[model samples]
Target chain A: MTQQPAKKLYIHDVCVRDGFQMESVFVPTDAKVDLINRLSLTGLAKIEVTSFSSPKAIPALADAESVLVNLNRVPTVEYTALIPNARGCERALKCELDEHNVVMSASETHNRANLRMTRDQSLAQFAEIVRLTNGTVAVNASLSTAFGCPFDGQICDDDLLANIDRIAEIGIKRLTLCDTTGMANPAQVRRICELVLTRFPELTVTAHFHNTRGMGLANCIAALEGGITRFDASLAGLGGCPFAPGASGNACTEDMVHMFNAMGYDTGIDVANLIPLANEIPSLVGHDVPGQVMKAGSYDRIYPMPDWLGGKEQTRLAGSGNALIDPECRVTEVAK
Target chain B: MTQQPAKKLYIHDVCVRDGFQMESVFVPTDAKVDLINRLSLTGLAKIEVTSFSSPKAIPALADAESVLVNLNRVPTVEYTALIPNARGCERALKCELDEHNVVMSASETHNRANLRMTRDQSLAQFAEIVRLTNGTVAVNASLSTAFGCPFDGQICDDDLLANIDRIAEIGIKRLTLCDTTGMANPAQVRRICELVLTRFPELTVTAHFHNTRGMGLANCIAALEGGITRFDASLAGLGGCPFAPGASGNACTEDMVHMFNAMGYDTGIDVANLIPLANEIPSLVGHDVPGQVMKAGSYDRIYPMPDWLGGKEQTRLAGSGNALIDPECRVTEVAK
Candidate 1:
């Protein structure tokens, strides 16, 4: 797998938007601004700052405008927000966002249940949102249930491709194929991603995966092997499918970035710097998140020898010629 | 990726031995026997019943002999046990086991820290254990930290191949490459596994992975793509690296099986039957486990619409022409 060099990968964090949207408790605007500012310095290529939805529908993100205005902008990082309709597009345009992400579902049942609109209604509304922007800001259409649906089961290849064509016709250049409710398999992900990338070579395709059934990272790998360069991930795996009962969170950000870097791809994001930020999420959300790297540490983290081994054995191990063994093993002592 | 069909896959469950060893609470011998008997019916190709290590070293499996003697074995399931030394091999031989798995570490620091023996000592002792078996039962060697070590950062490729060569020379036909602390990335796994499979075509290699760094299932995919067919998984994601602080459990059996089945591979194990058993593990171990499938149902599971949607909208949905929407969706009603 390492014999061939891979294309440079871009990691886009959706924690502040997708992740926080699922939280029942309201997060203070100052904390949201602080988190986004800290994330901006972590080398991420893009960050989804907030969602411009009706405050009554999503009370958790009612302070989206406040968060976008307060955060210190990083010139190198692209900032985007989720726009649900033409009203949302107007709000996002006022903020001078780098990108406006419009959302809809590939399946009719999901489109109705999630957005309370028919598939055609969603397409027309999305088209209006695109025209409202008028090329002032880039538009990225996120097609939910692209793999499979909780309301509607397996999505056919023809319908999925047709939906993409309609979204492209609305003048959108970027698309995110979302596995809403985490119903995707690796084989299916690889097949569909390859098909989309082949059919639309000019479009930028991003994969959005959920870890509800624990196939999130596996699907990410398949998408990567199928030539996907952009990904949507959540810090600390904080987002969940409110429609799917007992579902977990989205694909984790630090964990995904760590894998990409380990697999010899330059993601332009440092996982080590994302760890401390991820560790503080449980306190911010008032719950334990599903991130494993935050708890397990990085793969290269060297743990100290047990106390029973004593300093004599430790000293002997320190002098070993094997380069794999770190002589300074005692730098970070963890209780066994 | 699925253009060519894959070889038959074999799943081996090690929950009774490896999963319980790390638990602070000791599960009763009857429960262990019952769980193994139930697992036998799940169509698993092999089951690691228990370890014959010193009782002092693993109080959790102190009743190894009694549990192995009492469980009702299925004719199709091959039973195996972990043998730590010559004494353990003798005990396993007395039980008339189908296979005896002798373990050691590929890295010197991990070998000493985990087993209190040098690499030469472990190799010599493993050779003696193979000799003691005398062809009465199959011998499989598990090389820990084959991918990388928690104490030692990375195991060199040359050393890893050399260790495998030594194990093969000891007359062991089956070997498991263990990611002891989950230090492996997908690229490394695919590259090394391809090399091993090509060099040792006669050997049956099983991939044993830990979910410590959240790459367990992803690593499994890489290994599968590299031609590995056998896997060692733990129920409810039990078992962890004692040396790696805050490490999670092994790659979850139900989760991996779910992914494999979804990807169109026949592992001969029905994931639905394994889930109810996995759901009962937290009570058995007295804590929450890391398995995701047990909490989130299988991908095909169809949940009922929310009560607020009412019967009228649901009735319309029930009549939809799409095959994805199950008309019997109300059979399993879940509160959203």
Candidate 2:
């Protein structure tokens, strides 16, 4: 009898590229290397290592080459970099990359604002970057603002499909439909995914969602229902578009892994291993991260009962409703 | 010609109860009143005003009676409160409440921990609360931890149905199935809603979700498709159960409203009016709120170029290979 195919979910960790870019403090090159190295052990399918952008645009990833060079590469994991143009692609190629990622915004206005290029100009740049790199490195085109654009209003589903078709025609290895501003709802996500998958049967479509509008995971589920098997998430919900105003954070990788694992879906990621790396992020960046799992602990992380738990006083308090005192009141009432 | 019935969605704001209860600082009674007054103008169907737990248990709502007395009640809006027991019910009976909300956990352990009663005992108390009130106020039975309990693993769907049946037998006006720990997935949501609706078609059901595991909104959509129209949301994503480990925040009200409005579903809520109130929440409580729309702004609120100008930037971003950067790059670089 043929062995049943193992059911597994693929997660692409975007912390190094997307997560750090949103932070107020710049993470060091060594820290980025250490972060990616730690994350690699967590069993993520891919790690978006860095962005090959001009140093002037994003000061955070100025040492992208050094960070990539120092990483402990896991044989099973794919490491990728974001290339905004042919120049960025050339820089990525110089790093001896196995794969290069390019992005084009679905909205014309956003494309211009993001890359300072019109739609044709960005596509032309992508095709040229693909040619310049040759077949040595894989090319994955990310369609930004696929669900909705921050600068432009609702993106028509046809508009998104058209972008995918153009990218597919270029023979790119993969496509990630990004909800750059978290404007997608489940129905819209389902409709878009269904349309795209129907048109591009051979394309490997992935989802990248931001939690800007509180629908990140919801959109992810919709995409999964729409037949998507891969997703991009950031640790501790770190990362936002460096160029996109008002965008907050990406969907938390640990949180996503926790949800998928709880639902009996295999994500390959170990939530326990991911937690330490997630917690280290706040100290590295000089601010608390957006992810809750790192600070609050996972569903299975148990706290030992207090020393007074079995005592007579504890028994009295436990049985009474007074033990249910509002948690917030403790702070103010004590302060007073 | 017969016009199709306008699709309507109901908004049940949980700000006063869920939102305030989760915060670290205690909101003054007047501030709570002012917030509810502003929210009343936004066309919410119901507002969960306060909880009638003992002052010793939930000191944050020590002024619950005063807040209830001062509410600027709208003609169409129903004001509700959470009643924990017979004493809590007696306290709530003093207020001119349109509805009294009672809760029982599906998990026996959780019911014991949260209410100091077993699941059966909690249900028994709910029956008494129902009998004592005698239809004087609408009683909404909220089945907490209905999706899955943090203490216990997955809650059986049959157990949820059994609880609903027990509550319905007591003549409760409505029921809300709560994913207290955000353990619900879309498929599970669909299955539960279908099973419940099929078994009890006359019962009005609402969905209460948390964004803990990122599937909150996804689960909501699944319920919507499963024929659920009512939902509970907290403004600015406020509220978490302190006693319930791993619980984060509720679904953001403005985000849900935005999705409903964009999908052409009528929620009768003014999305624009909600933004200012959502924005003010972080300052009132001395911490940043979790909701994203108030910070990110809506799709239409972004930069807009006048349409009458026949702007060159309005051109489509995708079409043919003419949009390609270079054929050589497309053939060579993107081939892998």
Candidate 3:
């Protein structure tokens, strides 16, 4: 009978990693470490600290090693790092991170365009990374373009399930189904998530969605309905996809928390503390970010009563000390 | 099992009336009539054209009668007008509007502030208006501040239900529960909507939400889940409350329809045709509006297929026209 089924939803904050990866402006390593360190205290279930990609390729997160080594990890929080390839895993293993999050797009074309490898090649690389960190860390695979691909059109169900089937074969029990490029709708998300979960009941399902088409929160709600309990969100809705500039980026950490919390679903992340972090985003990224609740505030946050309503009109007495003309409110006295 | 429970969900667009009323600059009568005329053809269930309030009081919608008279009403569309008093009803009767939408706030304080009448007085006046236009037009009452009042913190459930009970007693068959300041939350919306519908099974319930706190679409989806069918949305997310300027206004018509359509619910409205109308709003209003899908295209709207993917990589061959992928996918050609 409950509308909100996720009584204690697990929120994964990805601002420092996936979000910063999109920023054209390179946030300093010290700033990244400081922000992640601050975010670690915000009651989030997980935080993806950084990506160990080649500095020549992505200079923004080039200092992944330094950020990871310097992080003041929270005891209750799981700290994961994005390992794009076996080399990235080698680099992250030195940092002694909590886990490794390997990513491969479900679409063969997107895989080739983004990772410079075919789907098969990417899966082999992921398997290599998974093998490298088999017992060293809790490794998980993120199936990007699980809903739709930018380079290609709608990802076929068999093609997507095949990728999930392949990753499951590699003993990767945890999976993050990503709507890369924000092309996911609710019905599509529900169908896909339901399909994945129903097939692999043992897999820990995490939904990573973008607000690309402005359905981030709505999609999140849908995914939750599809029995997804874990979410990946960015601070201040940062990490807007480089492809669709000025559009929705990652599902906003605070906005999602706000929505879930408002819906009576308990996501233990500190939504109030994240607002300050979301506020610092415009300055960090050097432009306005796309997060809504940060600017609009929490549903319970009361806006000041309008001046015109309180001043000349003595009907509602926040301004007036006037006694009620009719206690039952059947009639009202004329304004003095 | 069906994701789309509400097939042919009724969409009631309130752009011309509620939307324009918030504008600082006066939108001309011809423009209002033209927009309504265009909206009439968009397959919406209802359109609230204009409010029949005093022209001097609200200069923005001063020519309500002119706009109403000039409108080329589509046979399939229901045109309604907001009537503040019996005098406004008298004015609307002259134009022969399809329905009369009389509004009264659930919050006594808000009732005084916005309409300059106490809750009881507004109800009494609305009842009088209903009596005047009883058989001439369909009389529906809009209960503003049904969720929360800016001056008043949270409207109690009993008080809101009491107001609903009073209006139903007056023989009004249709009711709109409005989030006047966008203070409605999903759980609260569901609870109240369930209560009202359960108490009065025969009454048609329409939910009017604002995106002030960015919960507009989320709220709409919740209402749909709660078995409420009819909705009030404004074009281009227009009609921001005058009290809280620049924040979300009424739920954008296209955004809601887009979400519904995306979720496989049938709104019976042609969503594609409404985009042009949404696009024209920024120019007409002289300011930017808050609607998202208008800015971010529909979910399936493919973004140029990421040129680099098809160019150097040649993985997804749009330029080469490689004979259609899988034939089942309507494209062919394996990656080199």
Most accurate candidate by TM-score: 1
Estimate how well candidate 3 is docked, as a DockQ score.
0.27
Give the higher-TM-score candidate: 1 or 3.
Answer: 1
Candidates 1 and 2, the one with greater DockQ = 1
TM-scores for the candidates:
0.93, 0.86, 0.89
Clash pairs detected, candidate 2: A19-A239, A124-B324, A124-B325, A130-B333, A131-B329, A134-B333
What DockQ does each prediction reach against the true complex?
0.41, 0.22, 0.27
Best by DockQ, which number?
A: 1
True contacts kept of each: 0.57, 0.27, 0.32
> What tens digits encode model 1's per-residue C-alpha lDDT throughout B27-78?
9999999999999999899999999999999999988899989989998999
Model 2 reproduces what portion of true contacts? 0.27
Instruction: Sort by lDDT, best first.
Output: 1, 3, 2
Residue A330 error, candidate 3, Å: 24
- What's the DockQ of model 2? 0.22
Go through the candidates in order and give the C-alpha RMSD of each one to the true structure: 5.3, 8.8, 6.5
Q: Kindly report which residue stretches of model 2 are placed more than 4 angstroms away from their true locations once superposed.
A: A1-6, A242-247, A300-336, B1-6, B22-24, B243-247, B304-336
Residues B222-328 of candidate 3: C-alpha lDDT, one tens digit per residue: 78777888999999888876555445688989988987876667788767789899989988889877776776666555433455555545444443221323446
lDDT by residue for model 1 (A1-336), tens: 434544578899999999999888888999999999999999888999999999998998999889998989999889999998888898888898999999999987778788888889988988898889888889999999998777667777788989999999888999999998898888888888999999999899999999998888999988987789899999998898865545569999999998888777778887889989999999988998889888887777665566665635655344323343544431221111
Give the alpha carbon lDDT tens digit for every residue of B169-229 in model 2.
8888589999887667666777778888899887889999886656667677778888898
Comparing 1 and 2 by lDDT, which wins? Answer: 1
Q: Clashing pairs in model 1? A: none
- Residue B31 local lDDT, model 3: 84
